[model samples]
Target: MNPLLPIRHFVPDTEARVMPDGRLYLYGSYDISRETTYCSDILHVFSTDDLVHWTDHGAALRSQDIPWASEGHLLYAPDCIYQDGTYYLYFCMTGSYEGVAISDSPAGPFHHPVPITPADRDSIDPAVFIDTDGQAYYFWGQFHLRGSKLNPDMITLDVSTLNTCIIDEKNHGFHEGISIRKRNGIYYLLYTDISRGKATCISYAMSDSPLGPYKKGGVIIDNINCDPNTWNNHGCMAEYKGQWYVFYHRSSQNSKFNRRVCIEPIFFDERGYIAEVPMTSQGAEPPLSAGVPISAALACQMMHGLFISPAADNTTEILSHATNGSWAAYRYLSFDAPKSFSITAAAAINGGTVEIWADSLLLGSCLVTPTGGWDIYRTFRCPLTPVTGVKTLYLVFRGNDLKRRLMDVKEFCFYGDCGSGNAD
Candidate 1:
């Protein structure tokens, strides 16, 4: 079977959580303008009752509300931990150390304070995992990595027991974005090895304790084809309906749209080790029988053409037109009638025309307007006519002038029956 392709284009600085009420909530940075030095401090929230469709709940948290943050510093990776009756949001402020806020609800008007870890330590990408014994541990670090135990109340760290964690030496000590989970009395540490460029891989380590001397395990997922320059990193793992998944981000067409998130199915071997994860630059198939309906929200992993550089002056190659962004078509499906679908993108595109064709025949064209930054997620619905037995859909973008740019696509959702068969 073919791998799954990204249905939508762009979701930036991705963070995900499964709420106690049995719904999935995704929070991340939004309205990040490419031209601006700093993106918005707003945390946008989307919820899915079924993974296939999504409901936008708007901004869940904003930086202006956090008095500790600078006037325009970007709010990086945000994570949540549910303890007692409150949800704690651990996030990075101004790229220094990690700090946190608390709310009674998952969707929060969070209360922020000064940095949790000392500013001199240079920590970020905070992940909070509560052990079975009810002890809370905080994991954060990139180049200079560290982890420490937090008090049971989930506020401050237990300073006396700070533990320095191990990042793979094979990757030139480049490590950050640590995600931890305990299974069958074993602790697994998952993190990014970014030293190899597009060859960047997700590596793992194992330990007997939550705070541990973790021994390095080999790479779990390696070398995503879609992102030949960069691969998946900075994500979290969760179990839904008895299945496991890794949610992560890859570079968009370029740096401006570089951090869009995607997900793939994961499983543990009989020996209690994580099985090798499949890497796809595009996207992956939905998990089987997860009990949730496939909603538009589930399509978020689909890669729309983003980060394609602008074609050279007077260039006409089909690939050249994607100078600012590009996409690889996969697992194409056909339908007998017009199908309802949605499209979302990020960029400040002007005068660029998107042509959709099948079987070498022109279907139609739509004018794409740029969303002005990587953080604004836009969705559009339209009727797409499928060619009989067509196995591929072609998207062509033609820039009006040198000012033309492309955006990352987060996902596309089709409602109503087009045709039914195993697509990938």
Candidate 2:
């Protein structure tokens, strides 16, 4: 589903790199907050040979290990690059101070970190790109974008070569979290665009050179309704197996924290313009087969205070705090004459009804009875007026009390004439 990793893994502000090992590695800051805050001290790297399945390389690095960084929890955003058999992890911490860590392996417990900029220098969200002619460029800044050439050591920048205002809020709608890429000699810069008065859009800019006189492009993706608090989106662009993808994230828990990673396929037109992509439940893979159980936590549109929380099992998650008017929609599901709809739900009271809609078509509605407790789960089934073809799925909850919770939804699936398994 769209949240590329597990429900509890809050990985955001990511940069994707395809290493020589033939696996695409994800480098990003870890968020462990339930409150309104940003990053934690740890770094987690995930890899996937195939886009659908991912492998966690565990904790690759931590801010406390960096002897020079005084503010550990502010490990904002990171990017990795490979040069001459070594991998460099470019990271930024509090006060906008940038640093670099090294490891022989692409997925690393990267150690021996050193500051790239002086304590007084203002910088954040380090994006490193190497040009074709053997020159490397370092980019970072907030509101205003900055770029410079990195020294051969790769830890410090070439001071004399620093360039400022490569792109800015007034000109390019720049906010922060910049990722750089190039295609057919055209350099593209992806950053948090300030277009919607918030950093919810991933906008782009293009130039002829690595550090540029760039032109602003429109949005690639926007995370506007993913949660009650959709504030920012920061990700990078990558081409793998002749396909281009944008790695981004969506917020959960009805809070600014607990954001989960997501991906969507994107492409360029004849003039190389990238049209804005709508966020979907079927992310970097094909439509989820209706025969298999789909987690309720992978919802693409969570609205009206409907968010997901960890289930009592401590591993899986379930739809939480849902009541009347709190609904969620899943994008683009393949249905083949599905006969019945089933859900795993729980409630401490009389419960509620789940109105199932296939886009605008009302497939059916299931009356839910209380399971006596929110932690007690029971599967309920309702006969559906079967609908076919690929369509967006909507689950709208209706209950007597708007202020009280109706049910906690864990997982759900559709049954065809041939029958898929029960929702368990």
lDDT scores in order? 0.55, 0.85
Give the residue spans of candidate 1 off by over 4 A: 1-10, 31-39, 95-97, 119-121, 168-174, 222-232, 256-258, 279-424
What value does the lDDT take at residue 16 in candidate 2?
92
Best by TM-score: 2
Global lDDT for candidate 1? 0.55
> How would you encode candidate 1's per-residue C-alpha lDDT over 340-385 as one tens digit per residue?
5444444455435555555476655555566565445455445566
Root-mean-square deviation of candidate 2: 2.6
What digit string (tens of lDDT, one per residue) describes model 2 on residues 37-62?
A: 78887889999988878888998888
Estimate TM-scores for all models.
0.65, 0.94
User: Candidate 2: where is the Cα deviation over 4 Å?
Assistant: 33-36, 71-73, 118-121, 416-424
* Clashing residue pairs found in predicted model 2: none
Query: Model 1, residue 353: what's the lDDT?
Result: 51
